[model samples]
Target: MSGTQPTVTLSGGGADDARTVVRALEGTFGAPDERPGDGNATVHTATFAGETDGSAADGGGEGAGRLSAPVTVTVQGSPEAVRRASETLARVFTARDDGAASGDQEQERELHLMP
Candidate 1:
């Protein structure tokens, strides 16, 4: 991993959406380091080190070495999270976009989901 971990900041989603996004992220990168926010807005920040799946001890089984680098995820609240949640209102949702929503150069780590 590099000295600075990559971070993904999702903002504007409400509490429910925040929870949904957090759950979806957890499913991918594991639990977060810090989760703070309310129904109005929330923020979830987590750092993923190595493969989240417990396959390293199994001689690098399937899906192993997929996330060799560390990555960070920060889910903001209300609007962003709401947009993410709406993708699949039944359960959690993880976006597959190129992270290009607001014409930002650092789109790989920054995303602004829409409802």
Candidate 2:
């Protein structure tokens, strides 16, 4: 699950749920290269050119996401990006860290998101 850019892959829920979580991350990581789910796909992925300083959002966005069901999010990137992404998502949604795997330079973390 390593990538050049920090990538967020969302699954285990409706497309809307994926969009919701992705949008939440956007507040911290900026817009992604592609759009999120479109309604038919249960799984969606977005890759972001993460901030240079790796700063996170303060959660001053619009209304909170309305998830139809629980979603599983996998974040893959450098260790800093992965950790920042996990913290940003946890701030927006009810998140439970599933686990993590690491390599020399990249890492991946799985989280369960509920709303």
Candidate 3:
């Protein structure tokens, strides 16, 4: 999927905060979603799923422990857009983890990427 439009799913601990995080990240990218706050309250996520791959291998289907519907963030620029988007989401999770840690919470928030 080289040179193809890349998407980053910005999931969070809840619905409202997920949108906030997306907005924050999108604002950082300077291109917010057309319909912001569209994501619904998942078990605990705001999954922004977008990509050119239309297959089962992408893992975009209903399965156990899967929360919320996918929020497709269309990429229309250079590859750097994808990288920036992914980085924005990554920072959000990191901040969340830091917050939880500050509260003496030991929740695990891991972002595993497999190529």
CA lDDT of 107 in candidate 2?
A: 95
Q: Positional deviation of 41 in candidate 3, in angstroms?
A: 4.2
1-115: candidate 3 lDDT, tens digit per residue:
2333233344434454445444544333333333235456443332233332334222222121322433323222334444444444444333222221111321222232211
Candidate 2 per-residue lDDT, tens place, 1-115, comes to 2333689899988777877877777766777788774668868999987553334366522354778889999999998788878987887778899999999989999999886
- Residue pairs that clash (backbone atoms under 3 angstroms), model 3: none
Candidate 2 matches the true fold with a TM-score of 0.84
Order of models, best lDDT first: 2, 1, 3
Positional deviation of residue 53's Cα in model 2 after best superposition, in angstroms: 8.9
Residue 71 in candidate 1 has what lDDT?
24
Runs off by more than 4 Å, candidate 1: 1-6, 39-51, 54-107
Which structure among the candidates has the greatest TM-score? 2
Model 1: per-residue Cα lDDT over 24-89, one tens digit each: 444334445554456454454434332236332222222211221222233223333323322322
Q: Candidate 3 — which residues are off by over 4 angstroms?
A: 1-6, 10-12, 35-78, 95-115
Question: Largest lDDT belongs to which candidate?
Answer: 2
lDDT to native, each model: 0.36, 0.78, 0.35
